[model samples]
Target chain A: MIQLDHITWNVSGRTILEGVTVAIPANTYAVLMGSTGCGKTTLLEILCGLRQPTSGRVSLDGVDVTDLEPRERGIGYVPQDLALFPGLRVREQIGFAPKLRGMAPEELNQRVNRLSEQFGIAHLLDRLPDMLSGGEKQRVALARALAARPKLLLLDEPLSALDESMRAEAVSLLQRVQQEHSLTVLHVTHSSSEAAALGTLHLRMVAGRLEVESKG
Target chain B: MRLNRSNLCWLVLALITVSYLVFWALLLVATATYSTPDSWLQVLRSPEIRHATFLSLVTCSLAAGFALLLAVPVGYLMTRLEFRGKSWLDAALDIPIILPPLVVGLCLLIFFQTKVGKVIELAIPFTYQVSGVVLAQFVVAAAFAIRTMRGTFQHLSARPEDVALTLGCTRFQALWHVALPAARRGMVAAFCIAWARSLGEFGPILVFAGATRMKTEVLPTTVWLELSVGNLEAAVAVSLFMVLLAVLVLVAVRATGEKV
Candidate 1:
């Protein structure tokens, strides 16, 4: 379980998030929705250890990870831009985690191949991020994130950049991937339709608080 | 094409570009024509020429290498950081580039006269010494390297580094694996520019490291030395030599398959 206790973030004397508390059980998909300035991204950053909460604790799987670095916290994050490394090919990008951790070559190859085939990005292994289209890049980003196999996946408006046709496909792909891996996800988006379609647990950020709504 | 505003603008820009290239081509032709084979052979075989050429290579290479060492961290900090006095810090990084090269040399000369500089010079003196040549070249070259590196880091998105961090790589790993590889082209360009800048550096070297005959004489100072003795052909030959070296560097860099 991921537990956020009394998370309050104040920036330059302005309260972006105040006393925000929430709990997400393992393998649950929580869709966090709010307006542009409602601090949804800030909350995601706090969860991912990119930003520390002013007064709160972040617990991951019963361990207090509030003080842990982003790497140590075991959280996978995909920002709105997808932030793919242009220099690395899709295969290298997907296998970055195992490569960094010094996994054996055969095993690393196996892991990358498995994720690539699973995500249907095997054909794009040799392609760079710029060569891929919007939907392809989305799938590659997801594959790269899932290659590490974190306990929690944090996505900030992952589908916002997609065209109308691609957005629906991306949503389905995300749903299928999350379900197949039994991954716990916290996806922040401004689209109610997206929240309704993918959220197992619906939550909204109003002013500076998190309110749990009915499950979609 | 007709002389529409857009076509006219294109024509003007093309003419300006051609005019700049023409100036350099004209100078190269004149230097090559003026420098005869006998004079070139004499200058090439001369002990002073050999010494100056060797010293120029050694010092400029050292300067460019050291400039890169300082540029990477300073460039990264300037781009990827937010701190108090950041604006001032940004401006400070540009001081070397903005100051006249002569002023830079004068400053170094003055600095070595101070207590701090005197203490430093006591260990290994810089002014009017062999080390001063490399130091002078580095002071000017490093600024260009830092500027190029900053642009390199900025051209690359920070998201990849952030993603690398999330993927269990530490900050340093992110820089090494993701950021560095992405900025390789830029780094190469920066090094070449710094190398070229150091090769042609004159004012600072003249002021700080005096043009000692067999000690601190580099290519630029070689030109000055030959001219000072009224050896016009020798000076032209040295100038041609520098031009050839720069061309070789540029060609080698371009052959690396990365645009400068």
Candidate 2:
């Protein structure tokens, strides 16, 4: 479970997120919709510890994690840019976090292989991110985020850059991944189609205020 | 090969680039013609030339190594961190690059005259010593390396590091595994530029380290010394050596997949 208690964030005296409070249960795919600059990404950053709220407390599983670093917060984050490392191959990028956490070689390799197969990027294991297409990079980025097996996943506009054909495929792929992994996911997007497809808990943001639209 | 306007533009640019290459080729040819095998052997066998060559290699390498060590942290700080006076600090980093090398050497000379300098000199005196040559070279070369490295970091997106942090690695681990590896080509370019600059540094070393024979002399100072004593052939020989060294460094940088 994740709780954002009165999370208010301001930068340079301008409010980006104003007293936003929300609670998300485990295994719920929460979809957040907001127009450009409506604090969707800001909220994700705050949740993942990339940025801090001016005044708020974040509790995860009944424990306050407001003061913890991103690495210690036990969350997986994928930004809008995908940020796939250019130097690392697809396999290395997928296994990066787990390798950093000292997972054994055979286990890490097996995990990478399994994720690659699930993501349909097993053939691109030796290729760099720059060589991967938009959809391929998206899959690799998702695999990388899941490599560490975090309890929560934060994605910011993951499929927005893909073509229509790729977007439909990705929507199904993401839905399957979320259900199969039982991952608590907070996905931010401006597209209603994406929100409707994957959102178990639908929320909307208007001028820094969050409103609950529907719950499944 | 047509006489069209676009072809004319291409021809002009090609000629300009070729002209530059020809100028360098002509200089190498002139130096080779002037320096006979016997004269080359004589210059190579001379104790003073040999000592200067060895000292130049040692000091320039140390300076470049030290510059790299300083550049990595400074570049990362300048790129990743924002604090009060960050813009001011960024502008201040260019002072050494823009200031005259002789002025930089003069500033160092003046610095060592102060009370703080006296204390530092007690431990490691740098005025008119071989270490002074390294210091002089490092002061200027580090500025260039820092500039190059900062540009490198600026071109790279910070999102990868952010992702790494969200994963399981600490900040330092993120930098080591992701950032540094991404910056490898830039690092090679910076080091090569700094090394070449250090090798050719003259004004600062001449002002601070002094162009003494068999002492603090590097290749550039060796040329000046040889020329001053009416050894034009020897000076040309040293000049050719410097040119060859520069070309070697450039080739190495290119081999590492970075354009000069």
Candidate 3:
């Protein structure tokens, strides 16, 4: 579960998110819909610990993670740009977190192989991010994020850069993966169609406040 | 009868490009032609020239290494951090790059006479020494390295590092694993720029380290010393040798396959 209690983020004496509060249940696919420049990304960033809320609490899996670093929060993030490490190959990128955590070499290899196979990027393990297509890069980014096995996954406009066909494919992939892993996801997008397609719990943002639209 | 504006623009650009290329070519050709092959060999093989050559190589390498050591962290900080007086700090860092080389050397010379500098000198000598050559070179070279590295870091997106941070890595680990590797080509370019700048540095070394043959004399100081005594042949020979070394350094860097 992910919870934001009375979250308010002010920048330069202007509020980006004001008195915002919401709860996303575990294993729920929560789509946060808002117009451009409506603080959707900022809200996601706050939840991921990339940005701090001015006055509020962020809880993940019933633990208060407001003061915790991103790594300590046990959250996976895919930024809008799909910021894959330019220097690392797909395999290395996927295995990066586990390697940092001192996972045994055999276990790391097994995990990487499993994720690659599951994400259908096994053939691209040796390729760099630049060599991959947009959809392939998306898959690699998703696989890389999930390799760490975080309690919550936060994606900021992950499908915004893809074409219609690629978006459909990515939406199906995300849905299947979330179901298979029972992953709690908070996906920020401005597209209502995307919200309708993938969200188990729908939430909307208006003028920095969150309103729960529907619950599954 | 009349050229179009686009054609005129192309003509002017091409003329300037060719003129610059020809100027550099003529300078190399004149230097190479001024000295006889035998004199070139003799100048290169001479004991004093050999010592100066070795010292130049050693000092320039040290200067470049030191420059990189200072540049990486400074560049990263300048690019990644936002603080009060950041603009002022940025301008301050450019002082070494913009200051006249002779003035920089003079400052170094005067600084050693100060109390803090005297205390530092007691532990490690820099005035009128080979170390002083490196110090002079580094002061100038590090600025260029820092500028290059700052530009390098600026061109890189912060998102990768942010992603790394969320992936069970601390800030330092993210820097080590993600930022450094991404900046590898930039770092190499910075090192080469610093190394080449150090090799060609003359005014600072001349003013600070002094032109002592077979001791503190670097390639630039060697050129100055040879020219001072009316040894034009030896001076030109050393100049051409410096050119050759610069080309070889560039070639070696390219061979290392650090292309982005």
Candidate 4:
């Protein structure tokens, strides 16, 4: 499980996330829905070790990884921008994490091939990021993050960049990948429809606290 | 009536721009004969000229390379982190760039003249030595390199490194594979400009290193020495070579620009 306990995060001496406690159980997808400036991305950053909270703890799989580096937590996060390396070809971008973890070349190649096929991105493996369409780039980013088989996957506004038709395709791709990897996902988005479609648990960020919202 | 006004504005702008451009072009290029066959042969055959050119190439390349290597981390620190003295550090990195080259040279000379320079020399000396030229060049060129690299790091999204860290890459590895790859073109532009700055460094080499012939002379210093000794042809020859090198760098600059 991925858990946050009484987490308090302040930026520039102002509280952003305070006394937030939550758990994302294994193999379950949770959606965090809120209005803009609600600190959803900041929460994801804290979980992925991109940002450090002012106080409190983040735990993954029963171990406190609050102070650990992002790489040590076995958690994966895709940011709003997708953060694709612009100079690299799609295949290299997707294989980047595996390469860093020092996986064997044969294993990496096999993993890249398998994920590429799974995401319907086998044809885009050789193209650089600037050449790829928005949807293609999003798939590459997701594929790159998933190639490591992270214990917890964090998706931030993953469908915001896609057109209507592409979003339909991507929602299916996302569900399939989450199920196939057996990942516990905490997807943060502003869209209620997206939340309803993919998430079984709904939480809202209000006044820097996580609360179960009534959908009346 | 509207077309007449627009056409008149366009004609005046074109005329003024073309006139200035043609004048500047002729000043630099009309001297094609200034780069004579005999001077080329003379420069090639003269051991002093050859030695100066080689020394310039070696010292400038080394200084530029070292500056770039060091600037990557320092620039990262100044740009990406928030320390107690971050604003001060940012301002400090920029002081050298804005200081007149001659002033920077004098400051460095004083630095070497003091106890701090003495202690540093005990570690890695730069007092009237061959290494002094490199030291001088690095001081000036690194200022430019740091500025360039700071921008290179700024052009980066910063999210890639964040993602790489999440994906199990160490900070250094993330810098190498993710941010650096995305920053490839900027780094190349920085390298070219820094090297060019090193080659053109005259004030620091002259003041701190004393422009010793065959030992401390780079292209700019060689040009000065030639002019002092009344060898205008050789001075022009050296200047011509410097111009050619600058052209090569600008071509690289333009190519890199188009790539990004």
The DockQ leader among the candidates is 3
DockQ for all candidate structures vs. native:
0.76, 0.81, 0.86, 0.82
lDDT measured at residue B152 in model 2 versus the true structure, 0 to 100:
86
In model 3, what is the error at residue A138, expressed in angstroms?
Answer: 1.1
Candidate 1 residue runs with Cα over 4 Å from true position? A10-15, A163-166, A207-209, B1-38, B109-125, B247-260
Interface RMSDs of all predictions? 0.9, 0.8, 0.6, 0.9
List model 4 lDDT by residue over A8-72, tens digit each.
99878889899899877788888898879979999999998888889989999889998899999
Candidate 3 residue lDDT tens string, B1-260? 48999999999999999999999999889888887999999999999999999999899999999999999999999999888999999999999988999999999999999999999999999999989999999999999899988988999999999999899888889889999999988888888888999999999999999998888999988888889899999998899899998897787557644321
TM-score of chain B of 3: 0.94
Residue-level lDDT tens digits of model 2 in A112-142: 9999999999999999888999999999999
lDDT of 1 by residue, A96-130 (tens): 99888889999999999999998888999999888
**Lowest lDDT block of 10, candidate 1 chain B:** B251-260
Each candidate structure's TM-score, on Cα atoms with residue i matched to residue i, is 0.88, 0.90, 0.95, 0.91
Give the interface-residue alpha carbon RMSD of model 3.
0.6
Cα error, candidate 4, residue B96 (Å): 1.7
Restricting to chain A, the TM-score for each candidate equals: 0.97, 0.98, 0.98, 0.96
lDDT of 3 by residue, A113-178 (tens): 999999999999999999999889989999999999987899999998999988988899999999
Native contacts matched by each model: 0.82, 0.89, 0.82, 0.89
Off by over 4 Å in 2: B1-45, B113-115, B254-260
CA lDDT scores, all candidates in order: 0.90, 0.91, 0.91, 0.85
lDDT per residue as tens, model 1, B94-203: 89988999999999999999999999999999999989999999998999899889988887788889889889988889889988988888788778878999999999
